[model samples]
Target chain A: MNRMILYKEWLKTRWFLLAAFLVLAAGTFYMGLSLSKTVQFNGADKLWEVLVSKETVLLETLKYLPLAVGGLLAVVQFFPETARKRLKLTLHLPYPQGRMMAMMYGYGLAALTILFLLQATVLTVSLRHYFVTELVVRIMVTAAVWYLAGYAAYIWVAAVCLEPTWRMRVVVIVLLAALVRLLFLSGVPESYNGILPWLVLYVLCGQVLIFHSVARFKEGLQD
Target chain B: MKKIGKIFIGLSLALLVLWLVPWVYRIVTLESYSTPFTLYSCVVHDFTSLDRSDARNFRFIDRKGNVYGDEVQPLFYHSILASKGAFPDSLEGIPVTEEMVEHNSVILSAEPKEFNVKKAPVYLLMESVPVRLELHDPEDAFVVRKNGLAVYRMADNTLLEEKTGRFNAALSAEGFRFPANLVAGKPSHHKEYDEGYLLTDAEGKLFHLKQVDGEPVVRHFPAADSLDLRQILITEFTNRATLGYLVDRDNRLHMLRPDGTVIPTEVRYDPAREDLLVVGDLFYYTVKTSDADGEHFFALRSDDFSLVDRMDRPYDFEEEVNLCKYVFPCRLSFTSSDDGWVKPRFSDFSWIGLVVDLLVAVFIIAWRWRRKNTNN
Candidate 1:
């Protein structure tokens, strides 16, 4: 039954996932090309000097890509189910309702983790050619927060869509906005290093919020 | 499940209200003010200020509230005064020239944020005695690792084994340990000269490393081994009387001299919290340290680090009534004025505001109850 639910989620999101992967690949390719062009023009020493002295990550253009993909993935996966009231039918199945909801959320989260890993792998492989291990790690560590923000966005958006009433959805959104703002508070590379563990815990705690909205929907709290 | 959801949502709402409301209040009540530029004048023998507090009228005033109109220009702006043929012959009974003032003048500023931020371990070691008499960026950079120092050729990102071996041997001969705690240097070629880097080894021993020509000049200070050194800044001022400044674990400031002598200064400075600015001339060094409360000024004799004078100026806020204390239970901020790192910081809890918060809760419940009764 869990396998069937996971398959259903995959079927719903396969095309959107493909598009997101392609878009992310294109962005990574563009960044690589731009970095190569700079190295060719000014030599790699100048690039290294700038990276050492300046507060730039060089992967800034791709910062918001993960966020957009995460938010949109949530919309693609959940909006139709809620809009057509198909979730009510799904919840009425013989399977335990709590396990069913967990399976659905777990599917979405697992898919996002795999997708984000691929993006990070591509970045790591390309960055290694031009930068030292320390420099490469600095860029990756800085980009880690954005990827976490993506996960947080996906979870929060799912909760918002699953919410039963309009007033409560607005409240969830305001809270989510403030929470998201916390993830992007600093542009200084690796400035999030000290607080990253707590932020990860915060994102993990947010997973329960989706269950909150589902519980509301089960209570028939409609607007 | 329903009860947990309600509790979670309630807690989130409370956290948001506590964080955002005070933030919004601060933003809405923001005001603009500038600290007057203060400098101690050797000729006037008092602190002078350029007060542009009023946007329209600018005043140059001495500590005694005496305005000198434009006559004070020569005291601070010696170059401009010399260009206009108004430069004084002597200051404080000592004959002065434009070259003397220009060479002797040094402004050293150290902010807490600069020390707080993360820095790459790589360092550029410029040749102290360049062939063309002007400094140029070195072809390689070095990193201090647990094993020893590793030098990398910057052009192709390759290791320079020969140079690295030479430096490692030089440092080892001086009894320097592997893995430096702090490395400070003025790396830019725009400076008058390069002082290489001031490093504290793993055991808190001070070692000065510089490249004269193509070899390493390593000097280890055994005297610094007893002190718990926190930070060292290499200053390459044209005067060359002092090598750099050092901050010990107790937050006391010391001046590093050319003869390898560390002299404690009378200036009280906290390098991790306050901003320290030192404006030095031929006669005196005016050190200013500023924090949230106010700015503290110390004038020290140039020869001996004796305190010549001291003054304090408290900051004034435009808002007469601070609503933050009465309206906000606590405040949340991600960034701080003291450091460049972005991390969550919750501060300034007002126990007085809890009463207000309780009253607000009662009022909200009463209003909701009254509305429900009317509807029924």
Candidate 2:
């Protein structure tokens, strides 16, 4: 209900903001260097061509970093500190558990958005040298799917860590990996090259699973 | 009390089955079974042992004999040889070009938004196995089994060795049995570069066939060193059998083995003799040539590192050419030569049909689930 509270807290988390910025910076540098080289060699001067080319190079490098770091950070980012503090703070928060959970997810998603936008900007810059077309549209679709998947991963880790038992977390992660492999194996024969669909399906399923955390949240620093 | 419980249970079960349709449909109607024809492919190598990757393609034939088509994927060598990701298209983007559509002589009328025609078509069924190249001829393309021996049609409808074994055993193991109505023909009119053979049934169902030279006793080998036995060769090797070879565009050699192992060799090929020679790039094979007075040894360069010469005969051995060229390579080079045959192992599209069946089951289940939900 109070979305602004979540957004404000996300802005207040200095470490999280810094991490997001670093990811964007690294992504931009990688794209800039790659684009310069591509222009020198291929002469891809159209805005669309440059955008697709540079953005692809940039986002590909930045894609996995967010998922991995975001997942780990979810455990600590806004997690209540002590058992007493959790009751006094998270439990006594000014919103229903659903809205609070939504805020956490919102923050994670915001971080991912920033990273993708930076990567997309670099891609657009590269495309400007090439041509003006719907290259940005293609890049947006690809980057959005990737960032959403990463955000889901972050939320999943944060919620799992809130629950007690590291062993259970490990078990859940392994199970999730196995399910993804099954989906891939099932989809492959139908697809000519099955990997893309597998990737897309994993992100979709991950996002779905992340929503479950929101549906079943408890205000506790420890189980 | 018992009567009421039974009535409630029966109604719930009926409703539960109705809610499962869409999921069933999604699985059942996958791309594999969307088309009517079974696709068969092989790679055609150039004079050099390296395959012309772009030259990779497939052979398709319908069960009714009404349709046949050839789909050519892009060149294989460009990506590997260039060591650049700048390959024309990703394996998914490999297209059914005008050339491919024209090659099979199948009419092209429909264009859809789903597929990327310029790029992004499925090339190899498995990336490791190069997409099968349709040998040059359309109608002359044939794959058949005779007296338990696998046979393929060469240029001009000439029967050539393809594979051998108890056909029933291999087909059943591969989850494919011979089709009921068998038809036979070359894939296309051009046989100039195509040294392999093909076989089809009356219903247009197809299989790879070839004959081995030695004894009536059948021999079996693994199809590839990497994959499990189920995927190697289709079935157990039985007596009265022959061996089969597929020269892929990447110069990767696929040989069907007994006990169902598909052995992929890094050998070179001589298409004229339909033999696989293990000669490397720096090495050469010596074939004997006959002059008017005497026979002289001729040296043929083996630059591409192929397992077999693309022909049945050695390139320099035969004088008159044509069929003799088919025999020369078989006699010379590499290990003691077995009478080698080549056939296109048609993709087991039966999986797609299974998917469709599963979709129907899901649809029924979904409908029943929704009905129960509504009742509750």
Model 2 misplaced regions, further than 4 Å: A1-4, A45-59, A76-88, A131-145, A175-223, B1-376
Residue B251 in model 1: lDDT: 79
Which window of ten consecutive residues has the lowest lDDT sum in model 2 chain A? A185-194
Model 2, A1-223: lDDT tens digits are 4656665565546576677677667776786677567656654332222232231323455555655656655654645422234523553666775566556666766766666566667667654443322333444444444454455566556545443445544644654443322222211112222234544554444443333333323322233
Cα deviation at A88, candidate 1, in Å, is: 1.2
Query: Per-residue lDDT of B160-214 in model 1, one digit per residue for the tens?
Result: 8999999999999999988888999877888888889999888899999999888
Worst-scoring 10-residue span by lDDT in model 1 chain B: B67-76
Tens digits of per-residue lDDT for model 1, A1-223 = 8789988999999999999999998999999999989989987777777777788888999998988888889988988889999999998999998899889888888888998999999899898887777788989999999999888889889999999999989988987798788877777888889999988887888877788888889889998
Q: After superposition, how far is residue B97 of candidate 1 from its true place, in Å?
A: 1.5
Error of model 2, residue A58, in angstroms: 7.6
Give per-residue CA lDDT, model 2, range B1-376, as digits (tens).
Answer: 2234234334323322222232243346533311121111122122222122323433333222332222221232233423544333333343433333223221111112112111111000101111254232121112233323332221122333432234335544533435422221122223312212222322232344332221122122223323222111121112102123343434344554323444454433333232212211112322222222332222333232234332222223333212212212111111112211111112213444446556766998899999999999
